[model samples]
Target: MANPTRRLEESESEGFVISGKDIGLRMKALEYWKCAELGLQSNPNCAVQSFKVVIAEALPNQGPNQIDTFLSEHGGPGIQHIGLHTSSMSGTIKKLKLHGVEFAEPPATYYSEVGRLHDILGVGQDVQELKELGILIDTEEEGECSKSPRYLLQKFTKPLFDRDTFFLEIIQRIGATGFGSGNITALWRSVQAYMNEKHHPEKS
Candidate 1:
């Protein structure tokens, strides 16, 4: 499914693709991710400035599959996460935090390093603002340009279910349409830390 709709006066769209491949189709599995990147770029945005959500799931108890891991914990193949885009990630995060939504926050060191790249990367928001709001920034290279048009910000909500299967992504795109590939590792670590802190503080 792919269609743009209004989200609180902001343009939004959601695209979904499900494959029933069994384990061992490693190459095929990656196609889903690649397809998602294409989906985000191709989603129409005529009515308003657009945002996108990509939803994916696992087939069954596939080995080492994150989607399957979600299914295992959640009792079925279900929503792994929901990505919501915003123009003002700082303000949006602030409001959500005030409303008691927990998010995975990167450490000060992450922001410190990111700040050093601001000039070269042409980031749109202040490092301090992003750090305070627990937002992560990512930059994509466009053709021969030294830096991309705009950076992306993202934060993941604490899992809504006790089993840690589902969560929300608060996202903002300054100019880029693709997801933040650069932020994946840091975001994963942040999520792992958050999960450990919440589910097993002793392990943290």
Candidate 2:
């Protein structure tokens, strides 16, 4: 097990990376986001309910050393995961898992304590449903008074070259109309934890 970031850096140093093209794609994505905003503002009934994006290290089947070569040729820093919206996250997760979809394991506490938090935040979702799917919920503030319910569901597996790439996130929005800004930090923390475990299995 090796640190994924460290591995990426090492690969770069070894002249096997994709840097420039990745940057170009990111810039393009930013432009797309801007345009999407404008389009949404212009048309209220536009098809903007949900969208999915995947950002991951390039897959091996894409080419021999394509990921490394691409990263080496370009200053690689891009998306490596996708988010899919689902009417029923539980059903979706179960089906995806059955179909060989991999997921990252969030801390058990994320599942156990989220229900109490959801109740406090007044979110209208079934906590048990989330738990059954091994989803994790997070909020920005801690303690009794804070009541904003934003959550992150993560799962991990060795795919696309013995490296953790794609992950599935199931989001059920009640009042929020966009990605949960408050829960990002928590998601990052969970990712870091997964990476650490992947890099140091002995410790686990």
Candidate 3:
């Protein structure tokens, strides 16, 4: 007739780590024991994934005008751009550029390294095609001699202008999904730098 609660408290004081599965099992056991004491049935499926709660932000709250006004006064929104997915990013970028679209300057070395990593990872992308169409690419893979995956990420962005908003983005992916998280950071930094240059022109 020892106190189970006291034993658990002692175990925690001794730095005992419990796995998630073990905690779930213990909770189920406790529920079963309580049900038995009350002459009731214990449902084992109560711990299933179907009971998880998922929350999503509403779209109206994130409308263009609302976001723009918020950022204009608060020094650019942390999210400087949105990515648009396409099958041929290179071709899309080229066509857009020809139609007077503007883009941030992507580091040439970054593009080169991404291409090399993509080749090593068997991603089978067209480097020359990308070059001819002026698309920028970046990947998480290190390189051929590195111990990491060759290339598991890619990124692209295009700016759009309308009466309602300053810019939007056009992105493409072959083996990836969603916006490249760090890529957005880098793009935002670049935009800030450009704004700084524009406000305070360099002395010749």
Candidate 4:
């Protein structure tokens, strides 16, 4: 990845891609990520706890060739992560691991944080299991003094292709809908570190 990726709303696909400013491929390629997300979460009535698609593109001025491995292979300028919803996150993860899929490690202190730890236990999730799976849990609180809050569970697989350009995110949403700011910084830093190490090794 030549530049740090910027979040592009789904609405920008048509106009942004047509401008041909750094973004590679075209309308169809832009549509492919959305299509791919839908394809991954195909079962509508699987009684899934939660799932949503988040799309993004590269920020300009970093370098000339903007297209990354994911864009050239599975997705387009839509680099970053793809969140797939599954009813059974732990089960799915175990199965994926059995097949040799590796996931990104969360910050070591994630589960030790008081608020986050409370959220995990409040939701009745297994602390050890979550820690072992490297899942990050977040809550979309309801106002300051609201009674109930919704939860979001997520984990990102390391980039399957070379150089950390893209990855798959396994997300389970239980009445919550925020990209999860709780752990976003950690996630962002990991991606940036990978980009620097792989593309600008000297700076890294």
Better of 1 and 3 by TM-score: 1
Off by over 4 Å in 2: 1-45, 48-75, 112-116, 119-121, 138-168
lDDT of each: 0.59, 0.44, 0.40, 0.61
The sequence of per-residue lDDT tens digits that candidate 2 reaches over residues 127-185 is: 66766666644333333654555444333332333445434456644334433433333
> TM-scores of the models, in the given order?
0.63, 0.51, 0.44, 0.58
Which residue ranges in model 1 land beyond 4 Å of their true spot?
1-65, 112-116, 119-121, 143-148
How would you encode candidate 1's per-residue C-alpha lDDT over 23-130 as one tens digit per residue? 211111112333454454644443144334444433344444455556678897666677787878888988998999988777556665633356324654675666
Mind giving the per-residue lDDT tens digits that candidate 3 earns over 110-175? 345433435533556576665555444544444455554333233333333332234555665443
Question: Candidate 3, which segments miss by more than 4 Å at Cα?
Answer: 1-80, 112-122, 128-134, 138-166
Clashing pairs in 3: 84-171, 160-168
Question: Which candidate number maximizes TM-score?
Answer: 1
Scanning candidate 1 in windows of ten residues, the lowest lDDT window is 1-10
The alpha-carbon lDDT assigned to residue 167 of candidate 3 equals 52
Candidate 3 local lDDT, residue 73: 41
113-198 in candidate 4: lDDT tens per residue?
Answer: 65667788887889999999888887766656556668888878878776456688887777675555455544644554565566
Per-residue error (Å), model 1, residue 44: 7.8
How far does residue 196 in candidate 2 sit from its true spot (Å)? 2.4
